[model samples]
Target: MQNKLRIIGGAWRSRNITFSDAPGLRPTPARVRETLFNWLHYDIAGKTCLDLYAGSGALGFEAASRGAKSVVLVESNAQVCLSLKNNVAMLSAQQISIAQTEVSRFLAATAQGFDVVFIDPPFTKDLVPTTCLTLENNGWLNPHAKIYIETERSLTLSGLPANWQVLKHKTAGEVAYQLFERG
Candidate 1:
């Protein structure tokens, strides 16, 4: 059976969003997503968001439901991208865009900038720091944009972008969330 997930808040609260427990994919817990939106407050409204390593497009979908002006989800896996595309269609999110590409490739190719960027790379590899750096280096992140990063509790991010500052951080079980604001 497929796992049905609900949108945490905004216009689509309690609506079901489909997800799969497949290899190389892990959706952030609902509680964590809620905390994230809470931290963002009214910033989620009308902001463009980039969902890197968008497993189920859960984060981007939530942003859309919460009034994000646009959501761009980048995923390489064909199956996962299909699911993301389908879910966006089901939600009737006109501002949601799906890109079927590896996160690294998308990072290099993307010209679109976002007001908020969500990165939740696979925990098996230490990709978060490098990916964040790549985005910052490539100008994929707009100045003063907010970036939400999720990682295993013990993972350390060294040498972050000089302009980004940690605005808040919280831990939930094995997961740790960090919110950064670009200066």
Candidate 2:
């Protein structure tokens, strides 16, 4: 199925972005994007952000639309990365960049720091905790950076940075999402 998501707020508000029917590619729902942006309003402007496992680029594009200075969207799949690049070009989104690499490799190779990070790996992969730990250990997060995590409700986050604290959490059907702040 061809899937699409709309930007819920900021300059790209209401703009539709299309994606392929790639397996494991689930965009964040509109309601969830709205709520996520609300939580990020105070910190989003002019901040750098990372969207790890950026399957559909929904969260990364949303961050760019809402005034983030820059956004890096990392995805392992080449087709998905191509789609993301196409969307960026279509929108003339100079602030957004695409990284076509596996999340682990990208995290290991980059020393870039972000004020905000979005971690939404494929739900069945159990990547949340390990990705979180890598972000912390690899120095990808700036001081007090905000991290947004989306996972299957059945999965438990057992390996996060010790200093990180959950600032918000909610469930939408089988999806469980949380926002964290590193202290």
Candidate 2's TM-score:
0.97
Q: Evaluated with lDDT, which candidate comes out highest?
A: 2
Q: Which stretches of candidate 1 lie above 4 Å from their native place?
A: none
Candidate 1: lDDT over CA atoms? 0.87
Candidate 2 structure quality by residue, lDDT tens digits, 1-183: 456888888899999888877879889988888899998889999999999989889999999998999999999888888788889999999999888988989988958889999999897888887888888999999999999999998988887889999999999998999999999
Off by over 4 Å in 2: none
Expressed as tens digits, the lDDT of each residue in 34-118 for candidate 1 is: 9999999878898999999999778899999999999999888887777777788887888999888888888888477789999
* lDDT assessment of candidate 2: 0.90
- Candidate 1, pairs of clashing residues: none
Candidate 2 local Cα displacement, residue 1, angstroms = 5.6
